[model samples]
Target: MAETLDILVIGGGINGTGIARDAAGRGLKVLLCEKADLAAATSSASSKLIHGGLRYLEYYEFGLVRKALIERETLLAAAPHIIKPMRFVLPHHRGLRPALLLRLGLFLYDHLGGRKVLPASKGLNLNRHPAGTPLKDEFTRGFEYSDCWVDDARLVVLNALDARERGAEILTRTTCAGARRNGGIWDVELQQADGSRKTYKTRALVNAAGPWVADVLNQVSPHSAKNKRMRLIKGSHIIVDKLFDGDHAYIFQNADGRIIFAIPYQDHFTLIGTTDVAYQGDLDTVSASDEETRYICAAASDYFKRAVVPADVRGTYSGVRPLYDDGSEDAASVTRDYVLNLDTADGAAPLLSVFGGKITTYRKLAEHVMSELQPLLGFSLKPWTARMALPGGDIPNADFDGFCGEMSTRYAWLPQPLLMRLLQAYGTRVDRLLGKAADTADLGEDFGGGLYEAELTYLKDTEWATCAEDVLWRRSKLGLHLPAAAHKKVADWFAKATEIAA
Candidate 1:
């Protein structure tokens, strides 16, 4: 007989992990299975900002904007090690929407979220303000607002970790090949990485497969009769050298009714993105085209004195936004808000399918999802996740600065730069990774950039990391810094190590 679970969540992305974590914490037995590595899909491919998406206001996404803004501090508090506050500068253009309109939007973004932790929006005279130093002189005015930056992949892992700690089982590299509702129980068949198959029976099934939601309904649970559609829009990003000196990011108002983000990333590079184009290609093969590269570079060059062109880009990635198709003709105008379709067909087990969601709103989406499942769980669910901390996030009121100072003092033998890197990546858990190491040699071999053997081992051993790409690309952006030869060496080493271990 297959093992029975209270809930079975497919897809190891943020929403799946978040829902699994929340359900498990509420005393429900949960099993989460991912077709690939956690966050190997669209979760890690995000623009990596936890912003409220000020541009969405133009589409009147007030509810989404407010929920996302409120979740910013909440997420920071939940996972301080991987998330933090960031400021964005929006330069004023005379031909574009008036400054008054921009200011009003900022005003609404500030007040809508009941924001107490992040600072409010401030108007800036771009000619003299420090944020304007990098911008062209023609942009005489601008505005700055607060948002949060997150390691999207790590957030999913952390949520999965918390879920596991709360008695949830996370199955990475496992695919849900089949699911059927049978007599108030979901009979699920899974295909694991090593060619092993297992069946599971669960009271409920959650289809959190971001881009593959339709595929799941049609293939995984074919019996379901829910009418839902996913609008596939391709959003691409390019990582280039940091063009500005300040910590602030720049939000450019594009002429085609799209807003592009040039965010500070990795302390050495800038992350620029995202063109919304209607895509109908294979989800796994989404790549940033040459045209997309030129488009993004043009957007970046519009506000900066330094020119951005095709050659300046060092890395590129693309993700398919499985936006809930609301019949919007413009690809950029499609709503990012999510929807939960609960299915309890005739007299069978329930299937909860998740539609569209953003990196900023996954937590609340999870909360709402599970709340809808409260009646099925047969309990008066008390909300328990609001103020709780996720793993290493318990760093003294989420004070990242104070935590860094303490870490430096404790690891005085370590170089300041290396220690800072550790604190940024692992936060309070750096000590656990350090164990009894006393010097730089204890960190193991150096593989160029900020990557060390010790950290790589920690990631592989703990975070379900199985490949060099998972380490360099998704886990960290060091892939861009490592030369071709060094990159090949690391990739070769990882493959050899995995083989030997197997």
Candidate 2:
């Protein structure tokens, strides 16, 4: 006899992990499975801004904007270290939107979600502002607004961590092979990466498989509802050597009426993106097209004094956004808001399918999922995520700077740069990761680029990091800093470690 689970979530992206965290916290028997690494797809590939979708206001998406705005502050307070407040400089192109229209949008953005801790938007004289130094001379006027920059991958991992801590079984590299309803319970078969399979029964099933939402319904669970459709939009971004000196990011309005962003990434690089093109290709091997690379470079080159060419691109990434098809003529015009569909035909087990969600609204989406499942699952816990801090996010007053100061004093022996990176990555958990290590010598073998054996062990033992790619790219962007030799060394270390574990 298989044990029955209160909820079984398929997908390990932000939404799936978030829903798992919420359901597990509510005392429900929860299990979440992912086919690949966490945030290996659309969730990791984002503009990386927690904003109100300011441009969506043009299409009259006031509700979506307001919802995201509210979540923006909630997420900031919940994870001060990984999520930080950022100011955006939107340079006004003479031929594009008028000054009054920009001002009106910014005003609504400021007050829409009941603007609190973050500063309000204001007009900028690019001629005098430091952000203007890198911009073309023609762009003299602009608007400055507040949003937040997030480590998108880390956010997903933290949510999963919380869910695990609260008693959720999180399975990575495991695919929900198939599912069927029997006696009002879902019998699910999961296939692991090592060719092993496990079966479980779940009272309710959630198809939060992100890009594969439709596939999960049609192929994985053939009897499930198949009325919904997903619009796959490929958004691509490019990384280049730091284009400007300021911490601020730039929002360039393109001639096609689309917008692009160039944000300061990892201290030494400028992250520019993203193109919205209708995609109908291989989802597993999505990559930036040559055309998208040129498009992004051209878009950024339009505003910056320095020309950004495809030759200047150091790296590129692309992901397909699985959006709910709203029959929009333009790919960029498709809704960023999520749609939750609950199907309970003939009193059978419930199937909740989540479609088209942005990273910023994932938490709220999870809350709504729990709300929908409450009567069916019989859980009485109220919504508690908004007030409670995520894992290491319990810094007093949510003061990241103050927390860093305290950490500096406690771990004074660690290098300033290494300590800051760890503080940013793990927050309060840095103490746990560092443990009783007193100095760099105690940290063990140096893998170069500040990646020590101690941190690798912590990621493997605690964070479920199995491969070097997980440690280098997703867990942290140390791959960008480390040399190729160091990468091979990291890979060798993982191979040996996995062998030892097996």
lDDT scores for all predictions? Answer: 0.86, 0.93
Least well predicted 10-residue stretch by lDDT in candidate 2: 219-228
Highest-lDDT candidate: 2
Model 2 steric clash pairs: none
Give per-residue CA lDDT, model 1, range 261-373, as digits (tens): 99988888899999999888888788999999999999888888988999988889898888888899999999999988988776568789998899899889988998888
TM-score of each: 0.96, 0.99
Best by TM-score: 2
The parts of candidate 2 lying over 4 Å away from their true place are 220-228
Rate residue 89 of model 1 by lDDT: 90
Give the worst 10-residue stretch by lDDT in candidate 1: 220-229
Model 1 residue runs over 4 Å out of place are 223-228
lDDT, model 2, position 115: 84
